[model samples]
Target: MTMSLGPYASFIVTSYAAAAIVVAILIGWVVLDYRNQARRLRELDRSGVTRRSGRSAVDTP
Candidate 1:
């Protein structure tokens, strides 16, 4: 079987590609930010800072 995108094929394809690119960028940004925040928290913990709950930032539980 075969399908057609009609006259607006290029526009449709471009729109989909742009959306995918945007989503990929956002995901990458989130992952990098998470790693940075984790590192900062570890630093604070090492300096003797603790959360309000009295738990160390690096504590697992």
Candidate 2:
């Protein structure tokens, strides 16, 4: 089946295409960032580094 966009076809089609591309780019960036962060955390862990929090486990008690 053939789909047709009436008078504002170009505008509508271009808008949808642009939106799709933007969403794809955003998803790719998030995945890349997550991988990089995970790798950095692993390296830090290997070097015996620990994360500190303002509220300590001992303080909680």
Candidate 3:
């Protein structure tokens, strides 16, 4: 049931919807990246990989 929107109402609705979609995409990307990074760190720790040859943790960071 699509009804006619008053003049400029359609524009406002479109703009708000576009803004919402962009914000949602940005938030999802950030969350996914964070999770992936955390998972990688855990895996590295569990693998018994300690100390880089001739390189300190400070150097890696």
- List CA RMSD, all candidates: 5.8, 2.9, 6.4
Please report how far candidate 3 places residue 13 from its true position, in Å: 0.6
| Cα lDDT computed for each candidate against the true fold | 0.94, 0.94, 0.89
lDDT of 2 by residue, 1-61 (tens): 9888899999999999999999999999999999999999999999998787756888776
Q: What are the per-residue Cα lDDT tens digits for candidate 3 across 1-61?
A: 9877779898989999999999999999999999999899789879976647769778987
Candidate 1 stretches with Cα past 4 Å from truth are: 55-61
TM-score per candidate, in order?
0.82, 0.81, 0.64
Q: What are the per-residue Cα lDDT tens digits for candidate 1 across 1-61? A: 8779999999999999999999999999999999999999999999998787766679755
Query: What lDDT, from 0 to 1, does candidate 1 have?
Result: 0.94
Residue pairs with backbone overlap in model 1? none
TM-score of 3: 0.64
Regions of candidate 3 where Cα sits further than 4 Å from its true position: 1-6, 50-61
Which is better, 1 or 3, measured by lDDT?
A: 1
Model 2, position 45, has a per-residue lDDT of 92
Candidates, ranked, lDDT: 1, 2, 3
User: Which 10 consecutive residues of model 3 have the lowest summed lDDT?
Assistant: 48-57
